[model samples]
Target: MFCPKCGATIPDSDNKEKSGSKVVKNILLVLLILVLMAVSGLGTAAYMMFHNKSSGATYEGKGYNTPEEAAKAYAEAFANKDINEMLSCCAIESYVDNLDYEAQIERYGAYMPTIFGGPIMTGDDEATRQINIEERKGQLTNFIIRAYLRVSQPIDSPIFSGLALQVGDGKEYDADEVVDMLKGASDIDSIKVGDVEDCYYFLQASSNDNSDKIHKTLKKVYGGKIEWLGVELEIDGEDYVMFVDAIQYDEKWYILAPHGTGASIAGLDVYSGGICELALLD
Candidate 1:
């Protein structure tokens, strides 16, 4: 047999001599101690490694070691409609503060469909709608239950989950309704959420398409070089472009938004057009 975690072979007890068995048992005990210690150390190391010093609970890891890797992971998470995983790929501090789990979930529920796809409309099927409602209820219930179980863990609480959930006239978003907006689109590139500098660089790099005009305009306000990308689509028979704002952190890429995230990052608004407006990708 092989050890599940490390894939190392484990000898059967029956094959060992009496003395060998004692040695093996001792070795196993030592290995177990080492494994426990490693696990304890790894948890801390992982937290420190992935955590953003300025923000709270933000983590970007698990093979998302490069800009391209993170971008792919982001796209995959979107494709999977995994909200937590998707948010992990991007810088979400602008909207999501620490221990603001409800807001995190709500924002995720709202923006995900818009950025990735649209709401799933159950077409006049009573049973389907009921099932969807039940599924959402189950998810929320599970979250509550898990949160309750981990009540002792201070970090687990999103600054008191029950209070957060109960506050305000919280609009209940049916979780099942969220769908991927980017399903039909091709894979995303390793673009980053750079500052005004990215805009400057984008304009500088391009010889045509109003480069000089755009460059001067950027310089007049905030100047920096960063990558800017546009995803094109047609909505309601009209051409619409989704501008992607990305940033590089620790050499990995993250999209600010599939569209501009309602605010600027690094003193640069990736897209100034209306949320539904069209911008030709020149």
Candidate 2:
């Protein structure tokens, strides 16, 4: 026993006790800080989601959990002519305010031919310009929501019926009236959605040196991380693919509009075709 005690040296029990206590205190301090950070982050995310919903910046209904779910919902909404459901499927309104209004107006103006046959008037004053911008935004929003419905649904569809556009020729016609005038037309009977494909490699392949700029712009507008998905759609026997820019905040996914050069950045040459092409009657 004596030899064993000597070998152990009964070494500094008080010092060992103090050292162990210090280590425990340090571990507890680190854990406390980690807990606080997690709580703060969660609170911020919750606030954003609530604010978006309450302000009408995003759809009030429950957001789709996955990108595929969002794409399918959009297709179903288009086929069913459910404008509210279609709006719920997209996150476009959430980030529309973040875009350059002038650039957006210019970009979307190209689609006016498909929706209306006249120029949207604007004034030179700043206040008038802003008003015009808001009006144009509303018109585009309506067009996007109703364009496909006009093609697929009958003229009796509640949303389209009695809604008429007066063109320059003073002739008033609704979507069905316009679509009927197109030659070699095949109205969309149904829409089928395909699997969602990742757009990372597509971005990497196309961005070249401006990849950093593209990514930074997206992050600034959307969030820290964005998921780009290409959803394939089969509309009335023809195949088409649409790019969906999505962002996840607070564990929920929201689809974003490809504002600015987002479509070009994604290597999408969005020519007038498919829905856009069919919407135009010349």
The most accurate candidate by lDDT is 2
Per-model clash counts, in order, read 15, 0
- The lDDT per prediction is 0.38, 0.50
> In candidate 2, what are the lDDT values of residues 81-177, reduced to their tens digit?
5766766655443333333434434544543533321224434443453344344445435545444544455334443445455644555556665
Candidate 1 TM-score to native: 0.28
Please report the TM-score between candidate 2 and the true structure.
0.45
Worst 10 residues of 2 by lDDT: 273-282
Model 2, runs deviating above 4 Å: 1-60, 92-186, 200-209, 258-282
